[model samples]
Target: MKHVLVTGGAGFIGSHLADELLAQGYRVRVLDTLAAQVHGDGTRRPAYLHPNVELQVGDVCDKEAVVRALQGIDAVFHFAAAVGVGQSMYEIAHYTRTNNLGTAVLLEALIASPVAKLVVASSMSLYGEGLYRDGSGGVHGNCERTLAQLERDEWELRGADGGLLTPLPTPETKAPALASIYALGKYDQERMALITGRAYRMPTVALRFFNAYGPRQALSNPYTGLLAIFASRLLNDSPPRIFEDGLQQRDFVSVYDVVRCCRLALESPAADGEVFNVGSGQPLTVRDIALRLAQVMGKPHIEPEITQKYRVGDIRHCYADITKARKRLGFEPRVKLDDGMAELAAWLKDQAAVDRVAQASAELSARGLTV
Candidate 1:
């Protein structure tokens, strides 16, 4: 069996990917700190306790730890990172060290190891302001404008002869401009991975994942996206709060789709040295997601109240141009938002039972009882 080394295998997306890898007859070795709380009781859960999985509780920043885990590894999926934007702003040093230094250490270790392919988890936030360039290597303000509109629209960039320039997507051709420290760190990681791959002539693919969500995601994670938080509040009959106008859209791809991309990147020879945007082409607003979750959970009439408190640096509208991924990796979304929401609701319902068990365990522990 092929040995796969997965960093951050305890986190939401990482755990799901580990599960899928193990199911496909791969010998999965997971290395994670298990810092994120998944259970209601705030205890760290080991991602892979199965006999086939080898779990190592360690930080990726440690070169020794990374090198040790890389032994006999055929490929490495580097998914470890300091995840939230707002949180990264507060804990700058923490985010920088974990995201940047950790990735460097992993790359150094991979250089020494026999690993043939390395897939790095990158973010779409590296694209600053969503400005697109034209085919003639000129920047344009309004990318969506047509040739006729470019002639008429004052926002267009004009040539010396006043001709219209054809706009291009923010493709892999353009260098990533970091908008935040988080984005900067992630971009740096991708740069390291790419440079390292070029040096060693090893396959490297960076996946800029969109908003991925599904079951087993921690409810206590305050930095999580609006979908899970809203779903949890609605499940508890509390009013779900929406930040800003609730009109900001996101390409919320299912966790399964993200996993599929990971699997594809592992198998496809054409995926090397490519950055693929892993997301559903469909974009949904915050309100749409809230309404969908409510409708799926048998609370159709419920509507989330919009709150004035807005997140800092929250982009108004951002989605992926997933056509490249579809063409290259043969990736397409398998689950619709409603269907995914229904699956999430069912999983959350099951969590209630685990919650009870946790509460009972806590009570027994408090009483100094073995039960």
Candidate 2:
């Protein structure tokens, strides 16, 4: 039997991935710090994690911890990173140390004790803005909204001729436009792992996940997935807050589908040394997602509060183009948006979530990250 180690496997996506691995007959071991931000004041083992899996409580940046985690491990899935784009802007050193430096430490250990395969979790935030098409039907990858445009409330991207641009599905070929510290860290982690894997002859795959949401999400953590944030607000009997008219589009994929893709990346020889976008391949406006979550959670009366304010690094629209994943890894997202939201709502009914959205927004506004 093959033994697989998943860094940060106690968290949302990683925990689910661990379950999938265990079901597939792989012995799973997890290395995680169980950071206070995600796991609360006390770093106790999450009850949701499979009991059969071996859990190692340690920081990935610690060389001794990483070295120990790699012992007897045949393959590795690197998922240890500090999340939250807004928090990353102010806590620069924390994100850099945990995401970038942690990956470096893990890669160095892998060099000494080479794993047969390495898969790293990447993020779609690296693409600041998704691909767009001008009115002339020309595709443009280098489109960005200026501060002046944002201040004027011109939310959409436009061509040089001042014509409005339509958002196109962003493929893996699109050049990255890193807009936040978290994104930069993710990009760095992905590149570092792939480079190290190539040099060491370890097959590596990078999965650029969009918005992954399901049960066991850190509901109290305000900086988690968008759906979880909205659910927390709804559960607290507060209106879900929408930013910048809330028409900004994003892709939300089910965690189940994401784990399936991760497994495919681990097993597929064709996925070696490649990066694939793992998302639902469908775009939904932020406002629509909020409303849908409310409806599913039996809070249709609690409408979303649309705040005209915008965050500095926010993107207008970005969804996935999953053609590469479909062809290479045979990935097909089976869960529809409605079904996923319903499942999340059902799981959330019995859970208690601390409402920290207001506090988080205040912190960002104080730092001038939100306007």
Candidate 3:
């Protein structure tokens, strides 16, 4: 059986991908530091990870660790990084060093120990406000909400004479509008892996994942994954806070679908030297999704308070146009939205998810990240 090395395999998406790989008869090895933010206070292996995965606790930025993990690996999935768009704004040096420099170190290690396939994890945050259309049937996509407009409580994008702009599906061809340090780092990682991998003759694939959520999500990391944060609050019988009138849209793909798409990229020849947006084709408003999840958890009364408050650098709307992934990787989201919500609710019932949202909000407030 072929062996695959998954960086950050102990985390949510990577762990699920590892389980998928193992089931497909591939020997899976997990190389992760198991960061305290994601996996809790201790440096212990996550119990959610499949026991069969050969766990190697290490960091991707460490050359020796990366080189050691590459040994006997036919393919590599580079998914290790400090995730969170808001936190990255203030932790500029930390995010740059971890995401950008970490990828650089991995590329260098791969030169010494080449792998057949390399799939790097990217994010949809790079798209910023997504595509938009004007009243004149003109498409003006990928425009960010200005701070001045945000201060005025003008959440939606506007055109000439304050014409309302409607959201559009963002395809892979959309020009990236990096709004935060985290998004910039993910873009850098995507480009670095592709450039270095192609130059070294290694088949590379970049998967730009939207908001991925399911089991094993880190409730502690408030910088990313709105679903996890929402779920954490609901579990604690707290109101799921909705930002910006709760009308901002996002594409929430299941981790199962994400893993399947990742597997396709790892095995398919067509996915080489290409980038694909991996997200549920369906778009839902933040308010709607939070309510849906609350209903799933039998906490319909624990409604999401529409705070009308938004964090800086947040987009008005961003959803994926998954035509490229479907055509190239045969990737399609199979998990229905209701079913995914039900699954998440069921899994979270018995788990103790510490509600860190309050602390996270306070931290952001102190940094002026939240208005």
| Number of the top lDDT candidate | 2
Write out the backbone clash pairs for model 1. none
Please give each candidate's TM-score. Answer: 0.81, 0.99, 0.98
Residues 72-135 of candidate 2: C-alpha lDDT, one tens digit per residue:
9999999999999889999999999999999999999999999899999999999999999998
Candidate ranking under lDDT, highest first, comes to: 2, 3, 1
Candidate 2, lDDT over the whole model? 0.94
Tell me the tens digit of each residue's lDDT in model 3 across 1-371. 28999999999999999999989999999999988888888889888889899999998889899888988989999999999987898888988988999999999989888989999999998888788889998988657777888878888888875889988899989998988899899999999999998899999999999999899899766665999989888888999887789989999999999999999998999999999999998789999999998999999998898877778768889999999999988888999988998999999898777887888778888999877
Off by over 4 Å in 1: 36-44, 47-51, 131-177, 352-371
Flag the better candidate by lDDT, 1 or 2.
2
Candidate 1 C-alpha lDDT tens digits along 91-186: 689989999999989988877774778999998777643444445677743323233432342333344456745333344445565656788888
Better of 1 and 3 by lDDT: 3
C-alpha lDDT of candidate 1 relative to the true structure: 0.73
Q: Count the backbone clashes (under 3 Å) in each candidate.
A: 0, 0, 1
Which pairs clash (backbone N, Cα, C closer than 3 Å) in model 2?
none
